[model samples]
Target chain A: MMDPQRLKYTREHEWVGLESPGVALIGITDYAQDQLGDVVYLALPEPGGRVVRLQKFGEVESVKSVSDLFSPVNGEVLAVNQALRDHPELVNQDPLGEGWLLRVRLANATELNTLMSKAEYERFLHREGG
Target chain B: MPELLRTSLYDAHKKLGAKMVDFHGWEMPLHYPAGILAEHRAVRNACGLFDVSHMGRIALRGQGAAALLDLLFTGEIDDLPLGKARYGFLCNEKGGIIDDVVVLSLAPQAFLLVCNAASWDRALGWVQQWSPRFEPVEIVPGREETAMIALQGPAAAERLETLAPGLSTSLPPFAVTSEVVAGLLVTVARTGYTGEDGFEFILGAKEGPDLWRALLKEGAAPCGLGARDTLRLEAGFRLHGQDMDEDTTPLEAALGRFVRMEKVFVGVEALREQKRAGLSRRLVGFTLEGHDIPRAGYAVRAEGQEIGRVTSGTFSPTLQRGIGLAYAPPRHAEPGTRIIVDIRGRDAPGKVVALPFYRRKQGESSLASL
Candidate 1:
């Protein structure tokens, strides 16, 4: 439940952390993992693959159903969380820390301003009745 | 929107924080706060209770009851002893399965038929349409007034004994008995859909919540349909609409034992013709090599050619592996044959294995009796 004030959020329940200039670390939000239940498998995008904002970049499969992982920012994948291959439950136990999905070199840093802050995202969730 | 029906224990499920979902037209619990995995493990290791009130219960009375049931079901109905239950299928004239049901012989000319929830109305109609053939019979549908609950697992008998004295010892497998629990009359049948030793209670709808609370007080974990599906799949039990349907025969569904061929029934001629002509496709159990979950409607292939399709698939909590049932061509249906299940878009390697991916140890006497 790491609702870091600095991290940006999306309506689709993804989070983007500005790791460095023009680079970002992205993972599904704590709310997303809580809704998905125990994650059994993760299909991640390979490094050097292009990812478009608001598009499906990967998938998270629970025992009940599969949910698409939407990208929050346009970028090229620099690295994926390889450790998730052996232990998918990391997404459920530590979704914000060890469960980060990808590190991407951003295509447009200006897009970060359009994403919601922690307070705004919390309000959005409230508005949506979640 | 049409109104959704709720079971008598609906408020109890909500109080327990169960994740509710629409099952057919009934609002039911898909899983509880402990989740599907824990619920599944509880049933396999200890005991679990389920609200199965949505399933249809029909009561037949009068002298024509036995004859009517005999002509409708595939099994021998006339010879069933009192206080015993038998599992069988209702098939159409084309030998296709209509529904799989359990018939409990309550008395000399009285019986109870339990059917799947989704097929309740259709099954009732089928029985009603054929009732004229055996006149002077009373067909009473009991969905509105009755509720059903199942207590299943290896420890089910022990847990049940705490509530009803002499129930575990006196009631053998497939036996039914009437008892008074908490001042409410209940019909306890030693039968279950899950491949475990358990009892299904048919009681008044008004008394369902109290019984549910009583069972929980006796240390039975509350389970949902999520665990129910996986448990039944692990036991190699066929789901009516998935494994067999209006177009699939009992032989193709690997349920030949339940069908008594010597009897004259609705679909006897068609089944006899199928036996003479040989089955084109057969249902087979399979196991994946890894964690890739094979799901229903996945394409099954052999030697790079599509041979069949998966009917039911799930990650078995007991086995800790992916297991499924598929309908394959006769050549590809034998055990030990290698096959590929197209999961999502990737080809997952698997092997055709024997039915029942899980079996209780010998001398366990509970599930082994099934």
Candidate 2:
């Protein structure tokens, strides 16, 4: 589990890391992958696609069902994790590292303030009773 | 909300930290902490134990029992020898499948019908309605008093022999016998839904917890419905509600072999007529070329036109690929035929393949007699 202090989280279970000025990396949280079980496929948007905060960008499919992956902040997709096409299990094995879904050029750096801190996300998980 | 029914091993599942889900009103374990993937692999490579008590068990006893089943089911059940089982379907007069069942002929004038859990009430009612026609035959519902556990995989027989000595060795495929295990009476049947050698034990409901623990102690991994579904799908077994329904005929479901044409049974005339006219569509199996998963209700296409729909689809744990069964027009049902599945609006390419996406290597024990 990655320290929630270093990353911001969305209520829909995605995590965001501001890598540099105007750039961010995103992936689903450990809690999300644990709930989804073993992921078999991931459908992601192509590079150069624009996304808005809380917008549906792609989907993560487990053996049992599919869940929509929601964008946490507005951005232009710089690249998707192409390794996921052949090894979706990485989402279950290394959700914080190799399982990272996308790298993006943030449209608005201020959008990060609206997201929850690691402490707040832990409380949110507790409240959800998961 | 209505009360959700639970099986005898409900507490056992909870103790193992299994994730429970409601399956047709039955509160059952969907998977355990090891998850579906590991549970499925356990059943294929080693052995897994499943609590199958939710499935309906109906007992028929009387001089007219065999005769009544022969008329009601599509298979020739009257001549089924004692201690053996036969797989067949109960069809409506129109030849549409009501339920696919397995009947175990326990003795003369006595038999047991095991039907799907979801179809229990309807199947029992259908049997009761026909019971009067065959005088002296009694239709007894046994689910409340009985519990069942399926021990399945390549190592199943070896694991079973350690618990009930000589029981697994004495039984051949599709054979059933009553034995006393740990001072409890158990009806051991050499049968399973997964494409592997295994046995299903039917015993007193109260004894379920004890046997479940004993099996676990003997190294049998506790599995849940998630593993059961993937295993059955890989074996090319058709789930009743998904693969066929009251509106789908057995002929269209590609289960014609289970139907005996020489015998008089419900829907025989309709099946005979279907044979004469030829089926317009038939069930076919396919494997996706890539990682995209085909799911139930997904449209199947050929030549840019919608030809059919997927009945059951899943990522086969054993084959490590996407596989499914679908109903397609006869022209598109042949092996090697090209077809595309509409996965969330995108067309994913796949090709029709032979039934049973996985078969155990030669010299492995046969799982089913049929």
Candidate 3:
């Protein structure tokens, strides 16, 4: 499946989609979830918490291993996916949509320019030989 | 590091879109397209096939074979009837476990050892060191020429019965027998790692891929070692070097019953002394509260003190809770005793529980007419 072209990506395989004028959504990429095997739990920051660009904000633990989730841009957490607390499998089934990790009020919206597009992210995954 | 070795079923696993990982230097499948959770459930519900050729298989033959085994093993081997299998451990002189293994009596003078691949080379060294005393015993390392497959689940018998007629109902638990299926001669043992009624097949290496494909045609879901780990964890089986190491005695590893105290074996004196003195720390089962997954090396606390560390832990697929085994101080080792696990710095509430985390209803999980 194609990653939505409108989304921006991180080298660590997180995606950021601008939801509104300075608000964006975040979640792991499909490749990230597939590599993790089976999502069992996620430890995400609560709303109102500040996150820095390229900083670890959460973790995704699967049946196989745990991976850190990094912030794609500096922002204040607007909301976290409460449903994922009990149903983390959503990250494996629909990572880009229903499995979105958080909504952030972007503090440095210019940071989006530094991120990769859908095609660039696909090329990065290939370069990594995945 | 050395290049990883591949089993006979490697191509078959790749054909199923399996994710291969390095397991003790062997390139083994970690999971298939269904993932570990689904594969674990499939084995608990229907049937799951596994390529377990990575386990070390060494055959001992000749007059001195049984005696050689009797002295090396913690349990009595002479009383084991022909075609029967016995579980025991290879222990050092200090009573520490080297490896837990299964010995199958192929004939009056022949025995087969199914051991952990991680322990194969070291365990073989110990055997050779003692072989000269038991002359005429042939230590044949057959792992290179053989392949093992495990078919587990409640439907294992019925599904396997379709291919090998009359085999399911006839083979009893812990029994080993020979059978011919799909033109391959396989030694079928009614033994398994999962807490289910199942069978393990040892056959020629060249025929492993064919047998795997044939089982798939019979509706067995191909499983990988990832599911195998969860299944064994729920079953309360100890993984070599993870759950127990050379420093952990059989008694401390919750394997006291496997060590026959009266047996004249290498580690008997130390075990006898430990039995007299007492266990300082006991390997026990514990369950954690919601979303608290206790992983290996996590601290286990009791009475506001860090008393031990978890050895094997996981989120139980069947029990739907966090379950694990850890070495616990005696006061906190009893069932229902309150304990806490330090999960990455968060102290999560837990309790000492009896193994295994999941138990099949009578006559379930195996083909014992279920």
Candidate 4:
């Protein structure tokens, strides 16, 4: 089991709000990365691109499958984690912190309510069997 | 929860803390503790051993077996001398590949066919239906008492020699010989899925654990299905069920070369029809021009039009670039033709190229290199 107290999360297993306001961190959760296994490449949206909630903003390709990274909230992508370009395994190594996929400029604080709480996300993971 | 089939090496895999996943009903390890890239590189640089007991092994024996197989299979088995192996496909009534298999001729009227694990049932049924017409055939299902291990890499021959000296020197490509190695009777063959020099051993199930341990001790790193997939992909080997199926014909999948039109098989007529009609889609290899790794089911688009879908894709550890196999329109199937792979709603530029993405290093004496 991964640490549930490190960051807030979404029902889709993406973590949010690990950084200051206007520069909200976005990444897949530890449970999400573990399930994917041995990530090989990432297809993040270009910086300054607008993303809508629940829409696919990027992709994570592993040896087994390709997973779409859905946006948890409406925002503009400020930056994509460049470290993942060469070392996609980082997403599997540190899902919440150094492995963060993007920094988003938050458009609305209310969007956070749609995301699952830490405990709720944990239950979500449990139900999904991730 | 979905059920996963377990091989005899399940416990051995779990002991290594392998990341297990269901692959064609078998609970196989996708990778071990070190990770896919490291394990993949290990295979390219040194030897990596894999447990491939999940692959189906059927022993075909009896008078008229050779004639029956000659009529049923796509490749000519009559010419394959005893102890040699021939790669062929079991075609359906319409010339579509039922399953790709390797037929090992043990003797004139006896053979052993190895096929994809998932296609075992279909392959067995096809043999049973066709066997009675020409010869006496015995269909042995769940013959899981045998374990197959593949030792693959450039250094495979050298490392394998330490365990069983002269094993590689005596065995030619696609030929097998039975021997008592490590006090166990093992059939070692110079064959592999990876486009590397290697050997595959078929031994008793009870002796597998000891052999696996001995290989590891001898410096062959334990590689799982993950590295195996990447290596085979680089080698341009097709995976049944994914790359070709009952609905997919050999011609469409680029396996037409394996199908001998001169001989009559179950699907000869249909294959003739398809050949006359021409294929709408053709399997092609392409290199990802960017950071994206085009994965299976991802759409292949050219000039904003969906042309095809990827069958297999991975970041090649040897090339350090993304490459994949896909079936596309003939216009885009030609090598050097540019296209794009729609990776989760994003179009990543790519170009069709000749396969295999990686070539096996040739020795100075090999005629192909010269």
Candidate closest to the true structure, highest TM-score: 3
Model 3 / residue B127 / CA error / Å = 1.5
Minimal lDDT window, size 10, model 4 chain B: B361-370
Please write out the lDDT profile of model 1 over residues B88-107, one tens digit for every residue: 98999999998999999999
lDDT by residue for model 4 (B251-328), tens: 898877778887887898898888898888999999987677877889988878888888999888787778999988
| Model 2 chain B poorest ten-residue lDDT run | B361-370
lDDT of 1 at B205: 92
Q: What are the lDDT figures for the candidates, one per model?
A: 0.88, 0.89, 0.89, 0.82
Clashing pairs in 1: none
Candidate 3 stretches greater than 4 Å from native: A1-3, B363-370
In model 1 chain B, which range of ten residues has the least summed lDDT?
B361-370
Residue-level lDDT of model 2, residues B48-135, one tens digit each, is 9999999999999998898889888998886788998889899999899889999998989999999999998988888888889798
Alpha carbon lDDT at B99, candidate 2: 95
lDDT of 2 at B67: 84
Per-candidate TM-scores read 0.93, 0.95, 0.96, 0.88
lDDT per residue (tens digit) for residues A4-59 in model 2: 57889999999998878899889999999988888988989999998789999999
lDDT at position B287, candidate 2: 95
Model 2, residue B100: C-alpha shift (Å): 0.5
What tens-digit string does per-residue lDDT give for candidate 1 at A6-123?
8999999999988889998999888888787767788888999999999999888777767888999999999999989988878877888788999999999999999999999999
* Native-to-model Cα distance after best TM-score fit, residue B224 in candidate 2, in Å: 1.2
